[model samples]
Target: MSLVLGCNISTFDSTTAPADLFNAVRDQAIAAEEAGFDVVTIGDHLYATPGAPDEPTLEAYTTLAALASCTNSIQLSTMVTSNTFRNPAVLAKMVTSLDVISGSRAVLGIGAGWFEPEHDGYGLEFDAVSERMAKFEEALRIIVPMLRGERPTMDGRWYRVHEAINEPRVRDDLPVMVGGGGERRTFAYAARYADHLNITCLPAQLPDKLRALEERCAEAGRDPRTLEVSFATPMVINEDGEKARQQVEEILVQSGVDASMASEVFFVGTPAEVTEQLRAKVLAHGVHRLMVNLFAAGQDLDVIALTGRTLAPLVSGG
Candidate 1:
């Protein structure tokens, strides 16, 4: 039950190339591995935001493949990949290959997407919210069976598959982590399909979310604690709590999210203070895995390494 420290390599610069992004991720992965992080992750986005379209958007699988070849130990995967981007069967097969390439050190974190503009730009259907969730449910059914080395057919309103087979089963059953916090559908999906679960943007609701997950597990006839719970917090860590808060504020200003709201959601402080907060969060909510998102605000790789060196072992029981 050790804590995992991973980062999302989602850079917003249109001039960036896929190879360039992969190189940056590879360097971060190696640094994290050397610094004793348990995992490294990336996010998937097709179209850039309104003001951020020039953002470098690399395909998740390609970047992961490059990462697998460059790093030896840190388990790597997406923070959560959009379920609508590719056919579930294809995505499952790609993940299986990634697992093999990485010697079974891969996790698949999938999600029902949220960006309507990205969907419209890519010509993927921007279905109603309920329809999207339904598609996600069917996607899981199609993927899990194939990953288990079972060819299964599924017929759903959004996707149809017949005798889908994902060959070269991963070295082990690679862990599947689904992401979201909607209690009714999300927790239920985690109980039914995910080995790991990630949710963000609701630190205050974590305790309630865990309780809901427990209930869902019970209803699904699954052991409640069998699923691993992970949380991702947008964070800024400096030597001083006030300075860290200031840095987070600057990032907020850049992102137009109101600098005054920094302390409300993000964990910003010195390593000691952040560690205390992290421990409190973990103990209170039973979060076994934690990923600190440090995508922007000019964070150097060394800062993340220092985080692993100074903070991870302390909270993860090392």
Candidate 2:
């Protein structure tokens, strides 16, 4: 089967990011489009995590807006937006606006807010994991209908929207992508509302995640094939095998870890080796789309281009 592949420019903790942040991401988007990636995405976060507090991070939707004007053809999206970051109605309108600006190339990828530090830092609502998941479920109840140009009225426990209107939606089929591999809420939401599910599991765990997703779809009485599955993980590649292994070792060492543990989530190799691992771990497991995070190398555009070029041709749809 043909595959759908996308590159992520998520700067979650990339401290050595480019001095010109916007231009770097924009150039990455342009290069991704040229290299045949289906889409380019960024993480949605106000405060940095794991990395230093002062590390550069661009707000997700704003960056997408900028990328929309500067590039053409590539779909623009947040790999997964936090549901609590904006009010449900406001979130729906924001994505619709993005679709309008990008000429129908927007995918609203959202998740239950997990980073409590970011919530505390921004003074936004921070609930327990269960509560956040519940609110996220309700948010989808509002967002899905609103994106379809409907006037939805929901008296949700965490949110209430009455006859909310989102107009000027470019297409009736604009896709909503659900991120995270939660067996409970995220899976249910993907079965009910999302067109895609970006599984946040390590490559080795993908097969199990796919089965859980299918189970969720069955419980929802929805067709499982309707929801596309994408594996989300860090992809680090280099032309030299030794250099690639060194990069992996450096990351592991700096983080005070060992190579064996890091290898589960990080893919570091020459293009050919990367392709082999992806094929064996992801594609062989029946997942067809890959949302690879390649920003750990800072704003090195050549790395992005090489990674994209090597894999895109093999994964592109007809």
Q: What ranges in model 1 sit over 4 Å off? A: 1-3, 12-19, 48-51, 297-299
Error of 1 at 264 (Å): 1.3
Q: Per-residue alpha-carbon lDDT of model 2 for 1-318, expressed as tens digits?
A: 122788888664344346666877788889888877888888898876436556778899999998999988889888789998999899999999999999999988899978787888888989888889899988999999999878999887989988998988878777889999788778888999988888898777877888888899999999898778888867788999778777767666655677777578687788998888888888787776788787566357788789878877656641
Residue 98's lDDT within candidate 2 is: 94
Per-residue lDDT over 7-123 for candidate 1, one digit per residue giving the tens place of the 0 to 100 score = 666554444566566566677778777877777777778865324655667677888888898988788888788998888999999999999888888788899988888887778
RMSD of 1: 2.3
TM-score of every model versus the real structure: 0.92, 0.93
RMSD of each: 2.3, 2.4
lDDT of 2 at 304: 77
